[model samples]
Target: MSIPVGDVTGVEFDRNTAFLRHTFLGLFFLLLSLVLTVGIVAAVYLGQVETRTDIAFAGFFGLFAVGGWNVTYGLLSRSNREVIDVYITTEERTHVLCGELADAEFVDACAELVDSDLPTTNRNPKLEAELE
Candidate 1:
């Protein structure tokens, strides 16, 4: 649906939740890998188990390295922010607005604005009939 330009409302920028979640996951993986590598090294040094071949050590080290890289890149390059465009649906079309704001605040504001602008209506009978 298209909205008229005059019907457009405020725009807000919100935090990119996906980016934050992924970043957290990356850090968790990095820490987990480091602990595993350390535990393996400690086990070998303490004679808790028989010394394995170099391949085992290499594999553990590889996992740790990859995790570290992922966390580093995520922190250095990615910002946890995204643009959210808000629009009002008018008789003619929908008008879109975009700007930067806190994610929670933007959502609350958008919900309030949309609720005020639009009326609650019943479901479409044609669509409901198709479902059956």
Candidate 2:
């Protein structure tokens, strides 16, 4: 089903109950990678790694370094815009991103039509026809 645009419940954004959670999982991942990279550097600097066998850490450090770069690039490239998530609640909930529909006003009219309690559509056919 299409996510109704505008406020289906006519509530202020601060009072809007639809946003159930805010995610920062990427931040956690980025921090974890950074910590690992720091640990590897410290081990080398503190003379904890000396033998030819310690050459393995060079590979580990390189892997984590690339992962951190990818995360940084993604964070830098993300757009600054309001996004709508259309979702279904279930044992494992589903989320669908609704992009660019912010410009669609017909969706708001449909939501208002469905929410109306009065017989405005039946009483005034012209307004109803225009909305449809």
lDDT, each prediction:
0.51, 0.48
Tens digit of lDDT per residue, candidate 1, span 52-100? 6655765667677666766656764676654444444455554555534
| TM-score of every prediction relative to native | 0.37, 0.44
TM-score, cand. 1 vs. native = 0.37
Residue 78 in model 1: lDDT: 71
With candidate 1 superimposed using the best TM-score fit, by how many Å does residue 108's alpha carbon deviate from the native? 11
Candidate 1: which stretches are off by over 4 Å?
5-16, 21-27, 37-57, 72-77, 82-99, 102-116, 119-132
> How many backbone clashes can be found in candidate 2?
0
Runs of candidate 2 with Cα error greater than 4 angstroms are: 1-23, 75-77, 80-99, 105-132
Residue 4's C-alpha lDDT in candidate 1? 47
